[model samples]
Each structure stands twice: as structure tokens, then as C-alpha cells.
Target: MKLSSEQIKQKLKDAGLRVTPQRHAILEAVYTLGNHPSAEQVIDFIRVRYPGIATGTVYNVLDVMVESGLVKRVKTDKDAMRYDAIMNRHHHIYCAESDRIEDYFDEELDELLQAYFRKKKLQDFKIEDIILQIKGNFNDNSE
Candidate 1:
């Protein structure tokens, strides 16, 4: 899921953001890290390329990105905040033991859930996006 620098700048443009060295590097970092990176993880990654970048800058950029729907946030059971670069609608498979999160996409399941929820038609609640966090061990091969 790697993106070229031009593609990264295009994403920023689409998000109506001005492209700066830090913004470009941060967006690329989010995609390159590719592990639902936390703020700390993103900072570490950006720091390698941008040694003088500030922690606050990274956090502020992440907030802006999230607000613009450039990335989605994932919180582990331990309350660790993580960021996902994949913008498409998808859920997560969380492994508690390893603290790893993987994207899961199932169109049929999405349709089923949507239909079920639509049938309920709860008042005063607008369904914006459906996200599910499935928690378990990734390598559970026990008999």
C-alpha cells in the first residue's frame, strides 16, 4: 500500500491542504509505517527523515488529517491510540497479546450489518460510519 511522493502530494491537495515538507513526510510516514501507528510511532518515523520536527507538529498534523478524513483512529483495548492510513471503509482485527491491528474488509458482512441497522431506524441517531473492532489473538491454533 505504498504511495509515491507525487501521490502523497495529490492526497494533500484532495484534502485541501497546503503541502509542506513536514506534511508530505508525515502523510508518507503514516502510509509507510502501515501498522496502525500510534503518535509515538509516527513521530519516530518522521524524525528519521525530519530530525528537527517537533512532537507537537506531528500531533497537530495527525489531528488535522483525522479531521479531514485522511486517516482514521484506532484504539486498542489498552487505550493506545493508533492511526490507519487506509481510507476505505473497513474494520479492524485486533490482537491483544501482540497489540497489533489489521484491516478487515468484507462487503457481504457490511451489507448485512447495514440492512439490519436500517431496519431498526433508531431516532435521534444518524449512522455515519460503521466500524467494528474484533479483539482476539492472531495466531490461535490451539486444539
Candidate 2:
């Protein structure tokens, strides 16, 4: 979901966060790049147009955004943390070799997992979210 600067500001305001130029640029960079990006990737993107923005500033902005529910933090099996712009419920397909991530949404799979867990009925544990990371290599030439 691409958002204009004004819309991004409004989103931040709605989330009870102050809208700043750095935050706006960071959010815009994440939105523009649909693929899950690491902190360094975000910094590189922001630096192209926002040369003055510091790497630390980008990381801080991302942390605030994730905490405020404006973005999501995806953790791969390899322990690498990636930032996702889309807040909606979804899974990911992670490419091990390239460290690329792609969104995946499957209603049936979600329902199956929910039903299985409900039947199992683990005590004292609550499932907040389920994000499956299917690890593999992305075939670029094959559809």
C-alpha cells in the first residue's frame, strides 16, 4: 500500500506518534520497497534521497514504527530481523541464499493451523500471531 506523505503523517498521528521528516521518509522507503528489508537496506534506500539522515535515526524510526503497529518485524530462521511495511496478517517465503523475503497469504492454511492448535489446547500459552517462513531458493526463470 503506497501512501502519500500526508497520508503517512496521518497514519503516524493516528498511532499516537509525532510525524517527523525522518519518520516519514523511513515509512515511505518501506512502503516503496514491498519486500521485507533489513535495517541496513532501509538506511541505504533512505540515504539516496535523504543523504542527511543517519543510520541510527533510521533504526530508531523503524523500532518506533514497529512498536506502534505501523510496521511489523519479521524474524527469519537464521535470526535476521527484517521490517515489513504491510501490517495485515500474512506469512513469508524466505530465500536462504539471497536473503529475500516474499509475502504469502493462505486462508486455508491459517484455518488448518488454528483448528489443529485448538484441538491440542496447550495450557497457559496464547497464540498472538502465526508467521510461517517457508525456506527455499527463488526460481527466477521458472514461473
Best model number under TM-score: 1
Model 2: per-residue Cα lDDT over 1-143, one tens digit each: 67888888898999999888899989988898778888888888888888999878988899999999999998876665788989878899888777778899898999999999989977998888878889898889244
Candidate with best lDDT: 1
Stretches off by above 4 angstroms in model 2 are 77-80, 141-143
TM-scores of the candidates in the order shown: 0.94, 0.89
CA lDDT scores, all candidates in order: 0.89, 0.86
Instruction: Assess candidate 1 and give its TM-score to the true structure.
Output: 0.94
lDDT of 2: 0.86
Clashing pairs in 2: none
Error of 2 at 4 (Å): 1.6
Q: Residue 13 deviation, candidate 2, in Å?
A: 1.1
Candidate 1 residue-wise lDDT, 1-143, digit = tens: 78999999999999999999998988999999998999999898888767999989988999999999898888887776889889888999988777878899999999999999989987999999989989888776343
